[model samples]
Target: MRLADLTTIGVGGEPELIVDAYTREQLVSALNDAWDGDWFVLGGGSNLLASDEPFAGTVIRILTSGFARIDGAPEGFQRVSIEAGQNWDEFVAWTVAQGLQGVEAMSGIPGTAGAAPIQNVGAYGQEIVQTLVSVDLIDEGSSEIVTVPASELGLGPRTSELKRHYGEEPARVAVIAGITLDLRVVGTDPAPVADERIRAALSLASDDAVTLAQIRERVLAIRASKGMVLDPTDADTRSAGSFFNNPIIAEADARLLPESCPRWPVEEVAETVQVFDLATWDGQVPRVEAPASRVKVSAAWLIENSGLPKGFSLPGSRAALSTKHTLAITNRGGASSDEIAELARYVRMRVSGEYGITLNPEPVFVGVEL
Candidate 1:
């Protein structure tokens, strides 16, 4: 089947073998059967940018769906387990309807629940790491399923150990069968917004209180305005969510950027200090302190400053930047995979030449190079 019809970006060639697994057992069998050959799992197909060249391997699509409230949650939280194939936004909607408070700010993200932890999926300031308790996983060659804790996944800003970047291999090769999340049990009650960005976007005061449904409504609306929420009618949402991630750079490098560029400090561990008794100490020198902490700079700001603006496109090319958001490179009707790649390359080159920083593509590339 053509991956173009399957993916959100609507760009890709065909796969040699397509395996649709509708149950956990079938998924396991498919994975085991393809273990010795070239294979990859497909969930919602939202975070991929496949090539026009055909995929020379088996593609396993997970279609299983289900979720249930499990026992044994902390005092004010409730634990729920979700299948890997469940739609992400639908799950978020369910959470809001039930008045859960953790994932409300991440309402309109695409893809499935299983893919969340792979990239530490997040929006505004709400990340899966905040509430993810555990996941049922199986390694590449293992026949048994294991429940892995969230802490071991190496979750970080827009990345996790399992995520395969543009030209890098993941630290682990495994499939998540399901995930468990611990969400606050605040049914129909108002909760204070903890994320500064969400508060600013919603125009809520620091002391203001809002319901879970309210938060989800506002987040979805905001995403729609930026062409982030999926809609067949909106060509701006035709591409993979974000073309590039916000770059995290060293403090010195961040300082070299223009003052108007937006940047945020990344939390860093404080340097360890060693103390000795002055009276009984030997003549040993103390260790020097660590360098300044890193900061994350906005990629959209860099792109616009580098001579690329919203709706910009190369002459005679169908691929263009989204008119609503500069971070997205949209497929205008019949754009080819090569056209998308060309636009992405041009953007990267311009941004690098202007800011001396390389912008990395966020989507997983299959049989495609930047």
Candidate 2:
């Protein structure tokens, strides 16, 4: 299987075997077999950075399909179970149509529902943790299917127990089968009210009276403007969403910045990390969050301030920063994964050298490390 074919970036090499599972039972069996035989699990490939070299192992593509309302009180608080294979945007749209209000802000994120809990996927001031009730996982070590609640999973900004492997090396591999989200069924009017809050927070609303559907549409438009939404015609959309998780730093560290830095509640910040915005030497602003009760900083600001422009490139390079967004690194047709990795490394090193902070990558890397 060509990694390029599986990824949005369209630059990876190939895998030895690619298995697509369409049913829960099949997904479980495949996961068990792969665990016993030592195979890698590949999901939507949205948040991945793969190497250009061929992967010499089994690649199991989760195609499990199931969407049902398993439990709901008469009052309208319900639990919706979704398989990992369902496209996330479609799921969000379905929920919105059903009068659900929790996931509307996350409407345009790429990938599957199963991947949501993997990184606690969030956007537009909302995260999966707020709505996720439980996750159905195929325990790779035990080969048993278990339903773990959100608390048991240790969900932190873009990090989860499923993401952090236990035993042996910490960051090993684990496969997710499905996830259950607790959704609130509100009146159509209520949805619009909730959407008003979202739009207000995102600054996409000129007035506070936008309808729910209109809020969703406008948010999608905003995301599309930044290449956050998927687009076949735009190479800028050919990325694993944001390349770096906003950096969270200590409060003491944040105090070093000027008073203009934006500060929000720790909980509003990802990972209980106090976050602050940084003003670049060139006047651009970047936001950062610290997961350990500190502040998060912006890597994009650091990159640009550290002498890299939005479209920074080495001489005769095909890989460059996305002109639409500074945080994203793009494949400008025929670029290799190695070139991307080099660019990423260059950005990280320059930022660290200048700011005395290390920028961590947000995407999962397959057959490559930076």
Best of the candidates, lDDT: 1
lDDT of 1 by residue, 1-370 (tens): 7999999999998999999999999999999999998889999989998887888889999998988999878999999999999998899999889877788888999999999999998888788999999989989998788999999999999888888987899999999999999998889888678779889878899989999899888888999999999999999999998999999999889999999999988777586787889999987977787777899999999999999999999999999999998999999988999999999999999999998899999998888788
> What is the per-residue lDDT of model 2 for residues 1-370, given as tens digits with 9 covering 90 to 100?
6889998888777777778888878777776666656467667788888888888777888887668888653366878899889898888888877777678888799889998988888777788998988887776665677878788888887788667321123242456788888888774553234444465566754444544566578779988888888888888888777887667778777676555545443454444444445552655445654445566666677677788887777777778888787789888888888888888888888978876777778887776667
- Candidate 2 vs. true structure, TM-score: 0.86
At residue 112, give the lDDT of candidate 1: 94
**Pairs that collide, model 1:** none
List candidate 2 segments past 4 Å from native. 72-74, 164-173, 190-199, 204-207, 258-293
Evaluate model 2: give its lDDT: 0.75
